[model samples]
Target: MPELPEVETVRRTLNQLIKGKKIDHVTVHLARIIQRPDDIKQFEIMLAGHTIVEVERRGKFLRIIMDGLILISHLRMEGRYGLFTSSDPVAKHTHVIFHFNDGTELRYKDVRQFGTMHLFNPGEEFQLPPLSKLGLEPLEESFTLEQFKAVLIGKKTKIKSVLLNQAYVVGIGNIYVDEALFKAGIHPEQSVNSLTDSQFERLHNAIVSTLSESVEAGGSSIKSYVNGQGEMGMFQHQLQVYGRQAQPCENCGSMIEKTIVGGRGTHYCPKCQLYK
Candidate 1:
């Protein structure tokens, strides 16, 4: 799944491509992907004739701001968006297509068919599920070290599980969680309460810096992820431990190990991130 950096990169690329373009029509080949209004026709009618005012991202969800309605889209695993001329042949997995008045179309393709779209009225999106329960953005100024520490108090869950929880910190998935934990030199299986003040501070800084650097590098392309322009991310070159199982660690020359933590595959350097 694409994490914060990948989603932010998609938002940036999508904004550049589709912003200000009027939706001439909408075709939903997969009705199950539309979760709002529970009616496919209503979803199509509400979106037609409205211009895509802007594209914003809340956590991993893409907010397609239109004239009067907001379309919230979550691109789950194997989901991608691309812009192409109307004459271009639609791909086999293309699930949704937003035909623009300018003879271009914004297409959403999902191999797993797990992507979702919800249409909501302006200002009402955050009051509902998914977005309502999300925690603070790590990149934002509001996510201070004090707030982060406060959220972790009394939590008995493993640190990896806690980090994956959207209520604790939004937009972090397995890939970045492993990367962040490895960078902080904290074992993924450690309990949240076991972390000391200094460890928490290190973890906080690692989370922020890892995400910031990944976003600047266009996110890690570990899987099939790509931005709206179909460009692969460059951050995969900077990965420390994630997906480097059995490979030599750059810092200590020890073999990077992989283990299951909280049901997710975790990678770390055994010598660096030793269990406490």
Candidate 2:
């Protein structure tokens, strides 16, 4: 799945491609991919003639700001957005396409069919089910170190599991979680409540630093991830332990190990991130 950096990169690319374009029509090749209004036909009908003013991302969801309604999209595993001329042939697994007035189409292709779209009124989007429960954005000014540590208090879940929870913070997935934890030199299975003030500070810094650097590098391309223009990300080549199992640690030359923690494959250096 594309994490914060990957999603942010897609948003930036899509914004550049389709920000002011008007949607002439919409086609939903897969009915199950549209979750809003409970009817796929309505999803296509209402989007007709709607101008895409801007594209915003909340957590893993993409908000394509139209005239009065917001189209919320989540690109789950194996899902991507591509912009092509209308004359181009529709590729396989293309689930949704937004036909623009300029003879171009913004296509959403998902192999796993796990991607979802929800339409809501502009002001009502934040009050909706999925968006309402999300916590603060890690990049925002309100996410301070004291507040970060407060959230970890009394939580016995593994540090990685706690960080993975969307209710705690948004836009973090398996990829960033592993990368950030590894950067902070914290083991994935360490109890959240056991972290000291120094550890919390380090983890918070690592989260922001890892995400910012990845976003700057256009995100990591691991297994078919790309921006809206079909360009690949370059951050995967800079990864330390996420996909480097059995490889020497970049810092201390310790062999990186892989284990399943909270049902997710975790990679870290056992010597560097030892449990207390």
Candidate 3:
């Protein structure tokens, strides 16, 4: 799953490429990818006349804003979007295509076929499922330290699991969670309730700084992640702990370790982030 940074990158890139492009037609090569309206034809018809006003991101989902309706797209796992001339040959696994009036097409391809799309009215998207269920937008002005601490009250789950919960804070996934925890020198298995005031402050700052820096670097391309123009992210080079198992820690020179925490593979510096 692409985390906040990766999704934000895609959103920014898509806005540059497809914004103001009028959709002449829509073709759904895979029906299951359209999860809303429960009707493929309706989904296609609803999108045709609308011009793409802009592209926005909520957590890990892409919100393609049109003239009257909003299309919510989740690029689960290996899904990708690209703009190509209509004369170009459609590649394999291309699930959806939004044909523009200028002989250009925005194509969606997912090798795993796990991506999803939902169409909703303008303001109803925030009041409905998925979007409605999201918690804090960490990058926004509202994510304060005081607010972060308040959410941790009564939460006894492990630190890794708590941060991964979308209801607690949106857009963090396994890779960034591991990186953030390591940056704070807190073990992944540490209990959320056990964090001291100082540790809580460190963790909060780590989460913000880690994500902000990743977004600047275009996000970590650990898997098949790419931007709208098919560019690889550069942040993976700055990773400290994730995917560095058995490798030397950049800070302490101690070997990094990996373990299972909350059913996910977690990486950490054993010497720096002592397990309690």
Give a tens-digit lDDT track for model 3, residues 227-251. 9999999999999999999999999
Candidate 2, which ten residues in sequence have the lowest lDDT sum?
145-154
Candidate closer to the true structure by TM-score (higher is better), 1 or 2: 1
Candidate 1 per-residue lDDT, tens place, 102-122, comes to 999999999999999999999
Clashes by residue pair, model 1: none
Candidates' lDDT values, in order? Answer: 0.93, 0.89, 0.93
lDDT (tens digit, per residue) of candidate 2 on 156-177? 8999988889999889888889
Ranking by lDDT: 3, 1, 2
The CA lDDT at 182 in model 2 is: 85
lDDT of 3 at 82: 97
For model 1, the run of ten residues with the poorest summed lDDT: 129-138
Model 3 reaches what TM-score against the true structure?
Answer: 0.98
